[model samples]
Target: MKLYISLLLAAICCNWALAQSDPLTVATFNIRYDNPNDDPHTWDNRKDVVANLILFHEFDIFGIQEGLSHQVNDLDVRLPDHDFVGVGRDDGAEEGEYTAIFYNRTKFKVQESDTFWLAPETDHPNKGWDAALPRICTWAKITSVNAGQTFYVFNTHFDHRGVEARNQSARLILEKIEEINTESLPVILTGDFNVGQETEAYQLLRTAPGMKDTFDAAEIVYANNGTTNSFDITTSTERIIDHIFVSEKINVQKYGILTDTYHSRFPSDHFPVMAVVNW
Candidate 1:
């Protein structure tokens, strides 16, 4: 009887441990455009700083926005253990800007990956938006290594000043997400939306079928008050421009905006928003 009781206790402990370890962490960051305004002041200039910051977060999946080909290549070199999927935002071929998804090679398998331009002219890889420049969204179907569960991940960077572009982009993303949801797979969308929760774009995204902001799903989530002014560090004003939105099928364990204090060195102007979820 004693041996049987001990075995039962061990089995219970193992089950609890498995439940606790099933959560996956994901992040969305708009690594500021590599440009002159950034202090270590240069595009792709502070590669080490950016790489280190991302490594410190230890996210299982990352959705990065506004990265050029060189910048993405640099990160790939820096993070040898991760695999990335993305194409130039301008064309399906790898030649322009990108919204990329980086997943830990050991943690997830990329089943399918593709990019879509945020405009009515979907035939063209990147054209039709009234914004100053074109915008793109990258998506991937990923399978978790530990649980063997699969889900969809999407990332994008909306136009900064074009109101119509932002609204239309939201609509486009929603349509794509709905198409993918037919399989009933959980979905995660992350990026620099360039709009606040009160804006129409934000409202459109939240109301989309089966989607919910991770931060809103968990009432205890930390506010991203410092993330908006991430580029202009000199100012104290806050904006919640970056976000991680998850489909209702997934459970949001916790979510937070990674602040400057968490890093030994700052990587980009925008702080990364991370979410822990049970898939």
Candidate 2:
């Protein structure tokens, strides 16, 4: 009878741990850029590595920031089963960086997808406020194949040097969230904000009644906070500039930061953030 009770208690503990871990995995990665100046850490050298990382995690959905046309095209070749949506920030064509959102085509189907500039004239590729470049956000409405459930995913990269641009960008995204949500379905936002968690930009996004940082809301944040590491530093308390946010319709299960390194080489300058959620 003692042995039986011990087995039951172990089973209960296992079940509790499993319950804390999330099933649906989502990630956000800022792969720096394919600049020739960064020869040692060029995109060509790490694109396949990045693809393999995604495959290893088996993430259901993910967003990538600062991916160029060729970079995304390479991902398409590597991840043939995955479908992506986004446009270049320059001229609404494949001229500049793409904040692309990728999902497993086998698990989800795209209902609609588009790119909008984070500027006054959101219709075009105009730089808003004091932004250094014409920043843009890519969003998709996707439906789960088995459940037939629909949700929205937004991917973006905020201006690195413009404080006002970053704050305004948050407001613009908040408005977009409202405009996109008619069914009250789950909404996921992922990005490289170029700011820490305690800034105005973060506050603007948090102001949304339904939106919450996945890491903060998760039952277990396995990877901990401070997502980004500036390549040289092993760890720091205030380097986090990347994030993933989810609406109240979703329950965050687990959150983490990908800290894998191979041969002392990282896939990118910024570490990717991931989360598991129940929708």
Candidate 3:
């Protein structure tokens, strides 16, 4: 009986060690753009709130959608411990909204980074495929400072008004991932996809080979509702458009849709989706 107990204890220890090894906390937040019409919930009112949430959660790396250049600057000032990479979608040079990736500078080292428009002319900025507005994706090849592990992170905000644009953008991203990741490193994709899970565009990404939704793959989950709240606590939380997908090589230990609010108001219209993963 003592031997049996010892073997059980060893097994538990092994499993715990494996789960904790090189764990990374990643999140995707669609912080509503700094729109003045969203009064009472404008960026000025919620900038610190958003920064506080990121700090409190201790996110190692996170992607933000719908943040303008000034908003990014605000976060940069607030989160001095971290650094971000990405450019505005309008001109690729800080003119429009940014799909930015923020990382803890001391925890990870960026090996390479760039942004590309989600269009046939990926090399330059242009509206693509019946899109209402131009859209872009920002990606980075990052290495973990502590573990010396490298992976790719791609972040984007899909065009909300264009159905065809969303579909084409999804395909374009898949192709780009294949092209850019020559090392075949593990990939982490996060974004405000702007479409529900039932949509074809979402399904295309969800069914992509070597990719898995972290939410579905996690061993522990804390999602009680959908991601978008639209600043109204009474809003229906049935549609989850924001997402995070990872290469199959990574193991997602836990996933959550953080619905944290400040003084009964949301920091953003969309709730941030967070995952704890390890390779």
Best by lDDT: 3
lDDT of 2 by residue, 121-209 (tens): 89998899999999999999998776667889999999998999999999999998789777877899999998887898997786678
Give the alpha carbon lDDT tens digit for every residue of 27-54 in model 3: 9999899999999999999999999999
lDDT of 1 by residue, 83-121 (tens): 899988766767777899999999889999888888897
Name the regions of candidate 3 deviating beyond 4 angstroms.
1-20
Clashes of each: 0, 0, 0
Best by TM-score: 3
Indicate the residue-level lDDT of 128 in model 2.
97
- Greater lDDT among 2 and 3 belongs to 3
C-alpha TM-score for every candidate:
0.88, 0.89, 0.93
Ranking by TM-score: 3, 2, 1
Each prediction's RMSD over C-alphas, in Å, is 3.3, 6.1, 4.3
Candidate 1 Cα lDDT to native: 0.81
lDDT of 3 at 97: 94
Q: How close is candidate 1 to the true structure, as a TM-score?
A: 0.88
How many angstroms is residue 251 displaced in model 2 relative to the true structure, after the best TM-score fit? 0.9
